[model samples]
Target: MKEGNDDEIWELRLYVAGQTPKSVQAFANLKKICEEYLAGKYRIEVVDLLDNPQLAQGDQILAVPTLVRKLPPPLKKIIGDLSNTERVLVGLDVRRV
Candidate 1:
């Protein structure tokens, strides 16, 4: 399901405190975005801080429901439920084609 000439895989890391409403929404929004824009070229790794708090330190995540782009270099981060598709795409610097 890969698309375009860009063969670089998108490595996304989602950090959440627990199964709270915000965390749930973030995951849903992220999933939808990835499916639409990234499709099969992306991989999402969800990390629950409540289960393993130490994981947050690796990404320097200070807030819950934070999305971190671990690959494609220049690591990018977005904080929120990710309901805003345009902002998320802009923050990730992902082009729409």
Candidate 2:
């Protein structure tokens, strides 16, 4: 769903190395956040670096558990285990403050 008066869609990309614990946590945290804030309004593309390492170059992802907000221009990237929900929400523009 698009924000009223806005035609932009939220495009998210999560880059992970593998099924590591950190990656798992990141996925869980991200999913929770999306469900709470984005619901059916966003698209999450989880990219496993182990399966396709070359895809990392497209966003210059140098670390695992990186969350990239690709749409609406001025792409934003957050690199961490997604242990901090507030930070992730802020980075993704899903929540403020």
Candidate 3:
């Protein structure tokens, strides 16, 4: 198994509105995916739009429950509840071993 080094940290930001069902589900799914694939190499920052509406414009987030990969360059964004693990993995460019 190929393990990621401490230097390769995955900076992820999940933008949501309050604690809506979709937001909650997105967070749960993201956490599961990170734990399974990223392990100790990922960091998730949950951004509540309701609390800081201005944050949305910086990322140009048009929808809720959006997951943004900030680190590792070529920033990627996934919009949805993240129910599809395959899609999430692909979108995040995660290679399964």
Whole-model Cα lDDT per candidate?
0.90, 0.82, 0.90
Poorly placed runs, candidate 3 (over 4 Å):
1-6
TM-score of each: 0.91, 0.86, 0.91
lDDT of 2: 0.82
| Native-structure RMSD, model 1 | 2.6
Point out the worst 10-residue segment of candidate 3 by lDDT: 1-10
| Model 2 misplaced stretches (Cα beyond 4 Å) | 1-7
lDDT of 3: 0.90
Candidate 3 RMSD computed on C-alpha atoms after optimal superposition onto the true structure: 2.2
Question: In candidate 3, what are the lDDT values of residues 38-92, reduced to their tens digit?
Answer: 8888899999999999999999999998999998777999999999998988888
lDDT of 1 by residue, 1-97 (tens): 3334568899999999889999999999999999888877899999999899999989899998999999878799999999998899888878543
lDDT tens string, model 2, 34-78? 777677667889999999999999999988989998985679999
